[model samples]
Target: MAGRGLHHVTLISSDAERSCRFYACFLGMRLVKRTVSHEDPGTFHLCFGDEAGRPGTLFTLFPWQRVPRGRRGACEAWQTSFRIPSGSLDWWSRRLSEADVPHRLDQTAFGENCLTFEDPDGAMLALVEANPFTQPAVWNSSEVPAAHALQGLHDLVLKVREADPLSELFREVLGFTEIGRNGKLVRLATHDGAGGTITLDETGRLARGQLGAGSIHHVAIRARDAADQDALVQALHDRYGIVTTEPKDRIYYRSVNFRSTCGLLLEIATDGPGVDVDESFEALGMGLKLPSSLEERRGELELLLPSLPIPTCNRHVFEEIT
Candidate 1:
């Protein structure tokens, strides 16, 4: 039950380096760490969050180039969001337009005004104004000024063909409760102090989303530590009769993952031994890191991955700060 808050969202990409740059430069986020994915060491795994690489502020990138592109359907989470300041929506519009990024012409939906855009890999990204709703970021990045930087991931929409077993698991197993519903969408949030919204749709038909180019691979939640993550894993198994692996070290954190009854893969990751434990933020994200078992193969892993640069953003917020 240490599922404190939304720790991070992991997504699939064709090129980790490209995603690393786009998120850093455009969003004012810093690439805090780079490592070959422990599960699939052949691919690059990158994490971008605030300067300290805090838990709730993370956006992770995985390059699984060989996989086919996934289709966006009712069952698939098509878009993940970020909140900019209420009045800064105009500035974001101009910025995306100038970059030649295709954004859904500004629109109002779900009580917020947002300019939706796609990343180089095609993940549906949105820059929305935190209007009518106003508990702003306690801390924000320089790239997106305090006034315009992304607040954080608000909610995720899941397009499900059916919501029976999925809804029950979310309640009985995952500790989420029904907050609200609109038409065919059911919104569920956890009581664990994080703001994650899962929308189950019955009529929002969508094809199987391809997992390549730009798509979310899995949604990961934070566990206080190995013990907490274990408890969650056990609770899941006991509640639903689903078995999961013992905790596995992910270098930065320990994790236990399982695909839910709804077919959505969810992971519970420990919050300790962060990406900064071994390196300073000044020295962050510069090299490929390997686990102790794979330390001997570091050279091989490095050779397979792309040569990467330290991710930094050059947004002109300093001009405003002056």
Candidate 2:
């Protein structure tokens, strides 16, 4: 029942257009899928990732135009971090400045350099120079250069009232090993590196988090296949008395979700029949895609969902960098 790594982190956004600008244009992630939320057909579900929308690289969003801003506190996935090349922080700083995206250079307690920033909806994000550099999948089309493009998800930070119980579950059921600790921060990692790291920050005094725009919906861990996913679900039930829902088909992947001891939502997601299942590589994210159930009402749903703007590189900034 060893987990692969992270499948994706889902977040709520107030506006789809603003999210696209921040994530796609400025951050340089490609919008690999554009679809409607299965739960709420009126809302847009936008998925951003590497060129292929790989499991560890995905950041999916549900945009609710009128949702209120959320408050960040305990029992929340506080920040999402992406992996960047070791020497690319300076280039990223300059690019962030040029794009008017406010960010600051900071270091973790473990001394890894990171650039922290926020999206239009105020979702916290960071780029860390942790993992070894790898060529970006969207190199040719991204606003960022190949050398500096974001590689994939680095890790996630979870702010919890207590870390011990959750940490134990991760070790016993999720196959994570405690790698390091620094005061309130306890770091854990799976065998895989891409989106395998997690830092639990114990903040017992913080208030409970509220769900709304700008808050993380859930963090999904990778399940290699149906059998792997079933094994995990069984282990959780047998060990911790945790009950998970039956696997729900998400078009690209299947998922089973449950709440952690700290009240943070977590999901186990299978990795097959990926984003390329329905669209060709070249035409990914170019059109609105609907499931078979919704195909008949595509016109009505399209009218309900707001039109999204296509993301493109700013020629002025691109020229300056070139």
The candidate maximizing TM-score is 2
Q: lDDT per residue, candidate 1, 1-322, as tens digits?
A: 4235467888887655556668877776667788778878888888876666766667888877545666665455667776556688788878777767777756533456777877776688776665423343323545566666666666666667787677787776566787776677677776422245556666544555556667788877777887777777778888888887667878788888887776677777778889888787677776677778989998888778766666444433111111
The sequence of per-residue lDDT tens digits that candidate 2 reaches over residues 1-322 is 5768788999998877767777787788889999988879898889999889998889999988868989998999989999888899999999889777789999977789999998777889999997573444643345677688878888899999899999999999998899999999999988545688889999988998888888999999998988999999999999988999888988999989999877789999989889999999988888998989999999899888987768655433222111
Candidate 2 local accuracy as lDDT? 0.85
What TM-score do all the candidates reach, one by one?
A: 0.85, 0.94
TM-score for candidate 1, residues paired by index: 0.85
Q: At residue 79, what lDDT does model 2 achieve? A: 94
Q: Indicate the worst ten consecutive residues by lDDT in candidate 1.
A: 313-322
TM-score of 2: 0.94
The top-ranked prediction according to lDDT is: 2
